[model samples]
Target chain A: MSDDWSAEVEELRLRRRDAMALGGAEAVAKHHERGRLTIRERVTRLVDTDSFKEVGTLTGQGRYDGATLKGVTPAPYVMGLASIDGRPVAVGGEDFTIRGGSSWSGDRKKGGQGGFIEDLAASYRIPLVNLIDGSGGSVTSINKRGHSIFPGVHGFERSVELLGKVPVVSAVLGTAAGGPAGRAILSHWSVMVDGTSHVFAAGPPVVERSLGQKIGKEDLGGTQIAVDLAGTIDNRVDSEEACFAELRRFLSYMPSNVWEAPPEVACTDPVDRCDEELLSTVPKDRRKPYNMRKLIGHIVDNGSVFEIQPTYGKALITCLARMNGKVVGIVANNPMVYGGAMDVKAARKQIHFVEMCDCFHIPLIFLVDVPGFMVGRDAEAAATLRDGMRAVYVGLQATVPTYTVVIRKCYGMAGMGTTEKNGLEFKIAWPSAEWGSLPIEGGVAAAFRRELANAPDAKAREREIEAELRAMASPFRTAEAFGVEEIVDPRETRPYLCRFIDAAQARIRTSLGPKAKYGVRP
Target chain B: MAAIQVKADVAGSVWQITTKVGQKIEAGETIMIIESMKMEIPVIAEQDGTIDKFMVDEKTAISEGQVLAVLTR
Candidate 1:
């Protein structure tokens, strides 16, 4: 009986060793050199260390002969449960070594690797993190083994259905294109491994054939272009290590799913610590532009903001950050970029960011410097109002803790809520706040143009009217009407926001039905 | 040269008309203003053209994407 027990123990040990040998450090290192992380490594990094519990471990390629083979096949993608910041999460990581990390046979596998990952995240009610590093779904497998697999729009529909159920994160660690690109986009937050990768719906060859444009991958859909000009992708990084690290950081502010608030962690940046410098950060002169990004740094947890679409919609700043080590989405109107005016492109960019954060249960932080929406013929030519107002519409529908700070001017129809919608929470303002149907300078000319024209000193008269309007625009005047929430000191911003978020950390609602779905958009 | 219509992107009132009819202009040149929020948005010419027609007088209320002026290149 003792000998039988010993034999069973030895066999169990061998099985454990075989599991560990699936892809060891050497495989990880090889993928790292290729600007990618191994599936196991990515799963480990995305979730907490020693947290991931993988599924579908033995699924792989079939052999030609009846004889069995041990090292013949490897599951290219790792999927299953894990704890992110101590909360249960699901992860899908691509193993580049398996046919260079493309699910060469995912088409025949029926769900496509991306589909399986999406299903796991949805069924389990856990946030999904995709560590993509491949040349899309293996085309050779699909082209060669045609009748066995099917791919279509359903792939995208599955992801969209899973959107509001939980926070979806994507880390592009290697060349992601075609099907992989589709997977990467299903995230509220996405970051790319800079030197090692790129993403696009189609390759340059496809574009050249279809659109008659000869462009390289770097110029057309590199990380910088995607993050800056297109507003399609969210974040960009320098290496695979950074990409994995970013996945950990992004999950910090978002809950495991929409049913919960972001997990609380010990915060090193004390909430009470105030930066007095923020008081003087904005210059007294309204014409002069100052760095609003600086103000963002001062307010959130130290070095916690992972700014998305950093280059696109420069007038509006969107980022994911931690307040008291709990993830929050921060969107600020930047005076530096077109005086923080919401433009057609900016509007489109912000709406997507807002929806993403709200869907993921991240508390929203809005710094309203909106002098108004961008107006004029150029704006109209670009369908400015329609695109710009879309953000406001989306904002009104959000069921998250929204904190709006009136750093400066809030003007016109865009600023004043329409007939139906309610306003933001903690509607605080600065002392220099000013809002109206329009700026007084422009209004004065329209209302009393004859007086200005008749006066010998037209310039002087105009200046005087501007001065009076500026005075009326003060926060004290707004407070008298109870239009402003509170005139807060710049230093008090951190403490106030932190406390508000803490108190308002309620379970978020995800209204999507029991099954997955998606919407059609250009 | 024929005219091209450059429309307002956001709804607001015309703050000013920077260029008159027949003024030669280039792409991205601000020709008029629309005040929204509290700031004045300069309406720029989308293409290189000569100002052929003024769509609205100064201080006139406008909707977003409304044609503000016609330009001829």
Candidate 2:
């Protein structure tokens, strides 16, 4: 007898086919009918073609008839190693077709909090991409297990550790609640598809049962709430295809890991490509608002500006762009929104961007046009001061080289945050730039309050003081005093910034690795 | 014709009404100038349209997201 292993090998092939079927054809068809891609489809489309090498494919509950095995039902999680844009990354997602992608207890987890995929990313020091589409733990698990597991049984220790070591990206592909939703938030940057995806602590039924307030899923946790209003998710797109493209675009600027420098592409746009419109980008009329987005487009490399939190913080523009083919974080204030005041939302946005850039050793460029922290009773009630201070606090702690270009109005503590005070303290400005403890218009009124009140023409007296201070506030005067490093022609902004950003690469290279922050934020 | 409502992005008073009712305005044309935080913020038409009506007059106090005008495209 030739002890042939052909029958056992055939059984292995059949079990693999069952895993590939994924909750049977009926469930997969239902998933597709909803205009959503299956977990397998999502993984294939996101990574480079022919790049996915899946792990844990054979893990599932097995059925046996006496000594012969019948079939296997694959676990609700799929993950493995893959490459994005030629660099290796660990990617994973929940298989929503099986039991609504609830938490599956295998001998070991494939993906989720502390999953094996996370371990792969941490060990290899590569980026981790999580395509989240799960409802997480269910009450029915208790009946199957005979006891309920503790909350931290599958803790986020690995998720949190991966943030400081590698770039972690999360995409909410479908309705996410409980553990999966919490896992999505732990990523360094996260995105969600509009109309099809929703993420929250709990779903509508749970909210209604607990709070006595009935709400639809979309209304409770749609892109409007998660991305726009709350700033929980960083970006949103029209379709899943666009979401995949965005994810690829974002990782292009980031390094594979914090231990390395951010990838730089060849520059086709000339470093000295000076645009004449930059001279007049800021309106001569102080009260008039021009398009900051257009201004940013002109300065950065052609078609290289990817805005982060574009909808959430209208007052501030935060983007990852290339200067001289080198990656840079642009933090520019929007003059159109409340005169570019640092409101609570804008402050929160600034803090996150600064920290992320610092973590990856990316240089920062500040295009300052902020008036100050937002004013009025509403601003105070919203904790604008605390948040604004926290923004400044992070800015101070950031060790990365920062270049400050005062475009127009830079005033108060918000203005102070833009400069690299602890490091090089390099600042360049345009002719229109003005900075002080406060704007001259508001300062004159307060400083000479009694003097103006006593004067027969209070309005005239106030105007006289404002005019005198405004003349002294010219950027040229500051340059003459060497208070600001230099004042350049507005048209020279691109060439000048490119030169400095290129020069700062040496400093950035030497400072590569994980950044350790100290002190408590206000 | 489809009527589109234009809302204020910031809370302030109407400084000046730059467009009139029934005026044919192109996209990005200033509908009005709002004075908030001592800055003149222009409320521009998002699409090419004719001004149907002005919901708030010059110097009228307005809140954020308040409908400032309606335009028929």
Candidate 3:
């Protein structure tokens, strides 16, 4: 045999060059013309510089002239290990330039739905970032496999398990349907770029055939339907670069895995940096709604708040923020939307946010101003009461330390959910806080109905009873009786909650690991 | 020119119309105030635009997402 093995080595170099081409120049140019990034470019943009340790690069279909290989076409998916923010992550995405990034099966599966990427995240207990672009499970697969395959052969069992153990993030970078769309929903947090991305159960072709209605892809499952209306996607960004930035920001708040506590950073915003405007933030006239977002900005660590599902539930605001450098979840009621009442949508939003915070062992800060569960025929028809109660049920079951700050109105079962009744049962209030079973204005009308109906001046007598009840409903009286734990000025909210959150880290660290939730929600 | 549909954020009755048709309005300026659940919620213009038309008059009952006005930027 010849001592030189240069021929085989040269063949290997050519094969690697074919894989680097990534579906060739023309197809990649088409993808770029559509305002989307290729999988290779996306991976480069998302991960730390030169940190991608790519696996399965040599997987492709080879064309040979009697054992002398001409070239190879790479697989439609690319995946491997990478680091984000100097922390390890299993990153992968579908190569859309290759046959619209459809499923490509090699000798062994690579990633996307119960594959090596998910397995890597599970075994190593690190975060998994999925850049989903493929339209999953084409009918062409049946011709190749020579049979109509059963559903979920490459199932989501691993994806489901990863949600419980590690932080799973998905980004829909293209028009995703079927299996790919389902995978996007399995993440702890998911995002899609506006205009360039869309996700749905089926694309417009399937929808038109099933329903006999022609519709555009954007109309069916763009950010409006996916993020704002349905809340199927958690966040939407203007571009892919912004999407990547937000993904990094989201992971910064999360622990690498549930077994570890959420990472905290040093705080430059002082604990005692109380804004004087906090005192006048809530208006003296309660009917005139004030800016709750402005109020939140005044309290938390400066520039540390990241809102989740901001447009979907207009009544409630859920944010991941820092308090004295410790990561905290803020669930504040918006006074501008139905007086911050807990409607069906707001209830669903609360349940998800509360459960996520509890799972990650992040303490909660509830800035309450809810009057009660929403009222009206529309609310009743929508089963708002049931959903509202389920939110309360989930809140009661949460073991994380919750610091309730009653800013203004707190009434009924919706109000009761804000307190950490299961744990400390401690609640603090602002001097402006007022609490009761129901607001006295309406309660008096129902309780003293017949009395007021028979009075010489029913409206005047009703006002008198309301006045009497309002005097007794003062927060000071509640504090005097120890009904509430403490009453502080609005400016003291940051320092007060920060001190308690720092102290409760000891309790939070002890309870790390998967939280096994029990009982069916009401 | 782009026509923007300014929708109601809540189901409520229009309390007051703060702008007129054919008038210029800045982004973040209140176009109308809605009375809902004993609170006044302002319907704001999200972009700087000239008022195209009022979709609903003051005191009209409107549902969430009902167009309150049209603006041409």
Candidate 4:
């Protein structure tokens, strides 16, 4: 009986070895040559050292001859529970070396294992980090297995359930087309390696065949296309290590689940440390472009601003930062781009960013300098108004505390979207701030065009009208009319923002509960 | 080296031209300023280069992605 038990143990060891080999030594070497880490290697690097406890190591495709194994066993997917920064998390990745990481032969086993991991994370309320590198579903499987069954709402239902419940992150390390791409986007935050990763609904071959146009894989779904142009993913890092670092930073600002509040660190930077330079940061001459980034640095906690999509939406700046040691989302208008007007792209960017912040229960700080939504035939063609309306709708729906600071130009519908009309808790403005239905320079021409055209000196009359409108548009008048709550000095911004955070901290804590209604939309 | 085209990122009217043809300019030096959406955006040189030519004159309306100048590195 002892000899029989030893032989059975030996067989189990051989099966485990085969499953661990992935596609084989040569295939793994090829994968390395292309500058990609294996599935196990990625998971090891992502999690805390020696903290990973794998869930399914011996489950894979197997072949046998009367109880004796004859071929290599392939798991194709690896999953486990691990600790990241001493906090528990569930992680999984596709073994791309096996059948190109396609869901072909062992999908039933893969789905069972994947579902188990999701369930484990959901039950324990831990973050889920997926490192996806697959060829999505395989066409060859159809020929070999005589077609597959289609179930409505099967793959993404688990992800949807985990959306408002816990944080989900995905790192696209290699080509992630079709279903894998969908998973990457479904996560709350996603990062892709610059050159090695690509994501798309369909690869170039499928597009060429269907649309009769030739295109490269990089052009179709490279980091630049997916992140900068399409805004499909949150970030694009130079390497896998950078991607992991970004994930760690992003998760730091979020709770393990919505059941908890974001962790707070001790405040090191003095809340009242105001820079006198902020007084002159926004030029008195509204036409001059001053750096808003510099102003943001002086207001938030020192070195705590982490900008998101800095390149895509030039006019609207969106970032995550710490105000008085509490995580907050910052949205400011960049005067360097279109005079900080909300263009179609900028509107879409703000709408998406606001939705993400609202879903995570992060309070928002709006530093408005919007002149108005972009105006012209080009803006009309871009459907700027449609996107602008969406931005306003999302801005109003936000349940988190919203603090608005009208730093400069705040006019037209774009200004209205900066804060709710029902009086925000901290809707204050600076001396440089000015708000109106429209800018005097552009509005004067349209409103008194006929009068100017008929005047003895059309140019002089135009100038006179503009001067009168400018005086009426002063921030003082808005205060006198009770339209603006208060106008503080520029130097008071830091202290005010810090005070708002301190005052709202208790409210944020009390607001923590089940986020059953606000599941994030992909 | 290839000639780099300095492009306007937003639709606007050129307010001023800061650099002249044949003038050596450093990377990120403003070549021209465009007034749009009630603010001025500077079109900067991408690399250290000599200005080859101006593509648009002051007060000329240029569309987004339109080339404002050519610079030869």
Best by lDDT: 2
Model 3 pairs in collision: none
**Model 3: lDDT of residue A291:** 85
Which segments of model 1 are wrong by more than 4 Å?
A1-35, A44-47, A66-71, A98-100, A104-114, A137-154, A267-270, A322-327, A376-378, A416-426, A446-460, A506-522, B1-73
TM-scores, one per candidate = 0.75, 0.97, 0.97, 0.93
What does DockQ give for each predicted structure?
Answer: 0.07, 0.78, 0.79, 0.80
The C-alpha stretches of model 4 lying farther than 4 A from their native spots are: A1-8, A104-114, A151-153, A420-425, A514-522, B2-5, B46-60, B67-73
Interface RMSD of 2: 0.7
* Model 4, span A205-240: residue lDDT tens: 999999998999899999889888788877889998
Instruction: Return the DockQ of model 4.
Output: 0.80
Q: Can you give the lDDT of residue A118 in candidate 3?
A: 90
lDDT of 1 by residue, A1-522 (tens): 354687657644554454445555577677667655566766765667787776666565544455533343555666777887677776776667666666644443323344666787888887777777666654465567564456663457767767767778787776677777877887777887565677888878889999999998888778767765676677787866677677777776666676665666789998998998888987787765567888999999998877877767777888888888878888888775557888877787788887777666677888877767776677788877877777777776666667877777777755642111332445788776778888676688888799999989988998898887777677887788887668888789899888877766543333322322243322
- Can you write out model 3's per-residue Cα lDDT over B1-73, one digit (the tens) per residue? 9999998878889999988889999998889899988888878778999999999988899998888899998
Error of 1 at A481 (Å): 1.7
Candidate 2 TM-score over all chains jointly: 0.97
On residues A82-149, what C-alpha lDDT tens digit does candidate 2 reach at each position? 99989999999999999989889888888887889999999999999999999999999999999999
For each candidate in turn, the interface RMSD (Å) is 4.6, 0.7, 0.8, 1.0
**lDDT string, candidate 3, A1-522, tens digits:** 898989988988898898889989999999999999999899999999999999888888999999778899998889999999999999999999888888878777788887888989999999999999999888998888899988988999999988778999999999889889999999888999999999999999999999998999999999999999888999999999999999999999999999999999999999998899999988888788888999999999999999999998889999999999999999999998988999888998998899889888889999999999989999999899999999999899998899999999999999978888779977999999999898887689899999999999999999999888888889999999999999998898889888999999999889999989799887
**Can you give the lDDT of residue A413 in candidate 4?**
86
Screening candidate 4 with a backbone cut-off below 3 angstroms (N, C-alpha, C), the clashing residue pairs are: none
